[model samples]
Target: MVIVGSTNPAKLEPVRRVFAEVFGGLEVRGVEVPSGVRVQPIGYEETFTGAHNRAKGALRTPGASWGLGLEAGVEFNDLGAWLFNVAVVLREDGRTGVARGGSVLLPPAVGERVRAGEELGPVMDELVGQKDTKKGPGAVGILTLARVERVEFWRHTLELALPPFLRPELYPLE
Candidate 1:
């Protein structure tokens, strides 16, 4: 069984979906556990910290043969606005694997608003003259979207990260 260090349906659901789709028919189980990490990550290490810590911590728990963690955060850029990236961590034994997805650019106005503590998604919604809608690349936005929702999009994002972590043959979006 692979235990995920997140209880958020937003994070867990996609991890499960993508893993299943990518590794279906394999004897793998997807389970959710609390990550104990904040949602809005602060810095570069924090970007990888929440997810890495969760996976490492989950391994300490009982009944977890494998541990996984997913973390997302916005990084300030010099251009205009910020960029959001998602990190995925998978661990078993002393070996650890990490995977990351492409970034989503946040508009400057929206980025500044979010920097003040407002939620990114909700704030972008208001600015785009919509409500409760995702701005920027959205769930599957900036990357490749196969007509999936935010959760499903996240699922694929993690899925993409997994292969690289698991095999030297796959080096990520290089």
Candidate 2:
């Protein structure tokens, strides 16, 4: 069984698809667990920490074979603030795999809002005049105009994270 940290369908569906593809017939569940970080993690350290914490928290649940955590946040580089996604998976034996998805520069307006303490989901929802877009296409889909959906972003991250889990000999459980 796999336990995902967030109950948000956006975070859960991709994992379900990826888990089924790699580990057939496994049961997957999304549990609303705390990330133990800011509601809007601003940079890589906090975002990655949130993902790691969620994975550890999910592992606490009885019968959980694996814990999955997904986090999206923005990092400011010389050019601008770019949004990125991170996926972390933790197995029962304490093995972990992590991967990052593609990142897109947030428009100046959106970055300003995010820097000023607005959550990306609400910011995107307001800009696009849509309700709960985060649960659907999300900021990546909206920013990319559906070229890539949020689930797709997670899908790519999952694909990157799965290799180590799939090839335990190569990864060596270190």
Candidate 3:
């Protein structure tokens, strides 16, 4: 069984799809867990930390054979602000694999608000005039006009992180 740290459908569904394909016949469940970081993680470090913490928290789920944590954050650079997601998978034996999702440059308006202190979810909701955008298509989806939903965006990250688990001989556990 696999326990996902967040109950958001965007995060939950993708993990379920990927795990079913990678480790056939396994069960995936989403459990709400605090990221233990800022509501809007600022940069790569904070985002990765949030994901790592979630994976650790997932260990508490009863009968969980593996834990999956997905976190998205924004980084402001000279050009503009870019949004990216990190995926972390933790196995019972202490092995872990991490991969990052593709990033998209946020428009100036959204980027400025995120830089100031607002969470991306709310900013995106207002921009899209929707209620809970985070639970469905996220910033990437709205910005891309639904060309990429959150599940598809996250699926790429989860798949990238699976190579290590699939070929343990190539990626030896320390």
Candidate 4:
């Protein structure tokens, strides 16, 4: 398994867990990859694009069997606050499968404040009735209180999702 992007421990550890649990016998490794595009706190389209771009790049590397990309960012729905979403994309045999994960919703008022350019932390502090250091840890950060790191979350999502995409013959008729 090739994890496309940074080798930061927080990012890599989750990627490893997904490989171990899902693929069972495959080698899991992390390598820094270039997306050729960077957007701070990525949004939906960019996040997916970034992930796809990374997977393509990782595959070009010598000796790679599979490539994974995890990209997370904030996006606004009709409610208008910056909500969190993560994109996980995998490439093997020149084919790709992608899944997106996110928190259901953030407090609506908080989004309005974020739209005015305040950071998510300050807004979350008010919305959750907490104060200080609220949004500082992990991807899907405040939504999950830093538990299960985003990297791992994305990896697990992709890992569990693959069998269905690859082995549809096993599924019962709809």
Candidate 5:
């Protein structure tokens, strides 16, 4: 069985899809778990740590052989503050895999608010005048005009992370 770290449907759907496609017939379940990071992780380190922590925490679930975690955050670079997500997979045997999803440049105003201590979900909700856009099309979908839904964005990252698990010989369980 696979235990997902978040009960959010947005996150759970992707894990269900990806695991079904790859592992087949495995039961996928989402349970609420602490991310061990700020609600809005502002940097790569914190975002990655959140993902790892979630996966690790989910593995504690009974009868779970796999744990999945997906975390979204914003980071500023030379270009601008970009929103992205990181996915982490942890197995009962302690093997791990990680992959990062695509990023989108946030509007200056949005970045300002995020930097000033606001969560991206609420910021995006206000920008598009909607409620909980993060759990739906998300900022990427809103900015891209539905060209990329949040589920697909996260699925791509989860797919990438599976390579290590798929080919254990290629990725030694250091």
Candidate 6:
């Protein structure tokens, strides 16, 4: 079975779809878990740490053969603040894989709020006048006019992380 770290539908549904597509017939379940990082992780390193921590925590579940963690965060560079996601997959025997999702440039106003210490989900909710936007189409979907849904966006990243599992001979546990 595959255990996902977050109970959020946005995270769980994509993991379910991607794992089903790649591994076939695996049971997938979500369990709420602490990320061990700031609620709004600001940079790539911090975001990756959160994903890694959650994956490790989920792996401790008794029947989990694989643990999956997905985390989204924003990063500021000279150009602008970009929002992105990271996925970490951990196997029971300690083999692991990690991949990052594509980033979308946040609108200046949204970036400002996030930079000022607001979590992106709430900021997005306030901007879009909707509740729990993160668990649905997400900022990318909103910004891209549904050109990419949250599930599709995350599925690509999660699928990228599976190469290590698919070809274990090439990706020896490290």
Clashing pairs in 1: 14-155, 137-141, 137-142
State the displacement of the C-alpha of residue 54, model 5, in Å, after optimal TM-score superposition. Answer: 0.5
lDDT of 6 by residue, 1-174 (tens): 999999999899999888888889999999988999999999999999999989988889889999998999899998788999999999988889999989999999999999999999889899989999998989999999999999988998898888888999998875
Error of 3 at 66 (Å): 0.4
How close is every model to the real structure, measured as TM-score? 0.68, 0.97, 0.98, 0.67, 0.97, 0.97
Candidate 5 lDDT score at position 121? 92
Write candidate 3's Cα lDDT for 26-87 as tens digits: 88888888999999999999999999889888867899989888999999899999999999
Order of candidates by TM-score, top first?
Answer: 3, 6, 5, 2, 1, 4
Model 4 per-residue lDDT tens digits across residues 1-112:
5655555465566666766766667666667777555543446787677767777766666767777666655677676545554444455555556677645455566656
lDDT for residue 93 in candidate 6, whole number 0-100: 87
* Clashes by residue pair, model 3: none
Ranking by lDDT: 6, 5, 3, 2, 1, 4
- What is candidate 1's lDDT per residue for 1-174, written digit by digit as tens? 667776556666666676577666423334454545455665456767777777776666667666777776666757655544454555554555666665656667777876777666666556556554542345344224435456655665576666654585555433
Q: Kindly give the number of clashing pairs for every candidate.
A: 3, 0, 0, 1, 0, 0
How accurate locally is residue 5 in candidate 1, as Cα lDDT from 0 to 100?
70
Kindly report which residue stretches of model 1 are placed more than 4 angstroms away from their true locations once superposed: 22-38, 121-148, 164-174
Worst 10-residue stretch by lDDT in candidate 6?
14-23
Alpha-carbon error at 63 in model 5, in Å?
1.6
What value of lDDT does candidate 2 attain over all alpha carbons?
0.89
Q: lDDT per model, in order?
A: 0.60, 0.89, 0.91, 0.59, 0.92, 0.92
Residue lDDT tens for model 2, 1-174? 899999999999999999888889999998878998888898889999999889888888889999999999888867877899888999999889998888999999898888888888899899989999989999889988899988999999889988788888898864
Give lDDT for model 6.
Answer: 0.92
Clashing pairs in 5: none
Q: Look at candidate 6 and tell me the lDDT of residue 46.
A: 97
